[model samples]
Target: MPLIRVESLTKIYSSTKEGFAGIREVSFEVNEGEVVGVIGRSGCGKTTLLRCIAGFESSDSGKILLDGKSVSRPGPDRFMIFQGLDQLFPWLSLRGNLIFAMKTVNKDANMKELQRKAEYYLELVGLSEWGDCYPYQLSGGMKQRAFLARALSVNPRLLLLDEPFGSLDALGRKAMQDLLLRLWGKTGTTIILVTHDIDECIRLSDRILVFTKGTLKFNLINPLPRPRMSEDPAYMDFYGKISRILEKDANLKWANAVLR
Candidate 1:
């Protein structure tokens, strides 16, 4: 059975002048242990979809089912890592932040056991030595890594990521991508990643979903093998195809706006 099933999901913001539908009748399923990437331009409803699945946003119509149960509110079963590095508390050390998250969801968990899990996840993200460091003391990349560790420490059934590496420098982004791959390999966590970076999506996703104007435009499987290289002919070909699709969509959107 699919781990997550989003059926005809629609979320409209009435606050907007024209009542914008952030996501319009979107439907998709994510299988267990699958890494799905959502790619789209800004304001295209990628993040809205993730929020609906995470139960942070209520859908105007449609349903989100996880493990055959309807998702109604934010729960420990799903954890999100947003774009900002400010997710971590400045007053708390890295380890403390992770431990607190774990305890928040699993109140019956022993403090010592939570600490052990926190340390393990910290080391998994290559932040073992920085556990005692505050969020302010870490670099942007380090702060992101800590957030990832905290999210993973709870062993969530589904991980939702919204452009988690979008704010980093080129080098920092690359490092975080590699770190994420390694961590995913170890944890086998089902993930839904929303990103503007096409290369990053292709590199990390088992399947890619393209969104345009609050609608799903394409659903493509990644034919490339693991440890994908940019120089590979197949990789470049797939990249061009996706780029062209996005370009075409952009042009269409511009033309429609001009006509209106």
Candidate 2:
């Protein structure tokens, strides 16, 4: 069975003269240990979909099922890492942040045990020596690594990422991508990531969900092999295909039929 199922989920921001904006009957499933990437232009409801799954937004219709249970509110089962470096607690150190995250979800967590786990995750993300540094003390990339480490500290069932690499430079973004894959390999955690970068999506996702104007238009499995690069033919082919889907969908005057 799928780890999470979104059934005909819809959330509208407004139906007034300003016009409607939100996901319309979007549905999909993420299997266990799968990394699913959501790619779309701005205002395409990809992030909205993620929020609904995270229970941050209430859907107007349909439902979200996680592990066969309906999700109605935010819980520890799902953890979201945002695009900003603000995710880390400014008042807390790297190890302190991780310990805080653990204590929130696991109230009975032993202090010594939690500290050990926090340091382990810090080392896992290459921040072992930076545990004493504050959020402001770290660079943009380092902050994101801390966010990843904190998220892993809890070992949540599902990881929700909203363009987590958006603030980094190109080189920094690529480095984070490599880090994400390495962490994903070690953790085998289920993840749903939202991003506007096609190359990033292709590099990290097992499957890609293409959204256009609040609608799910294409659900394509990554056809490229591992070690994907810009020069690879298969990678470019998959990228071009998704690009065309977005381009063609834009030219559509109205919603006709959504591609699977």
Best by lDDT: 2
For every candidate in turn, the CA RMSD to the true structure comes to 2.6, 4.4
CA lDDT for candidate 1: 0.90
lDDT of 1 by residue, 93-180 (tens): 9999999999899899998898889989999988999999998899888888888899999899999999999999998999989988
Error of 2 at 1 (Å): 0.7
TM-scores vs. true structure, each candidate = 0.94, 0.94
lDDT of 2 by residue, 32-131 (tens): 9999999998888887898889899999998899998999799999999865639888899888999999999999999999999998999999999999
Off-target runs (Cα >4 Å) in candidate 2 are 16-19, 251-260
Provide the clashing-pair count of each candidate structure: 0, 0
lDDT of 2 at 191: 95
Lowest lDDT 10-mer window, candidate 1? 12-21
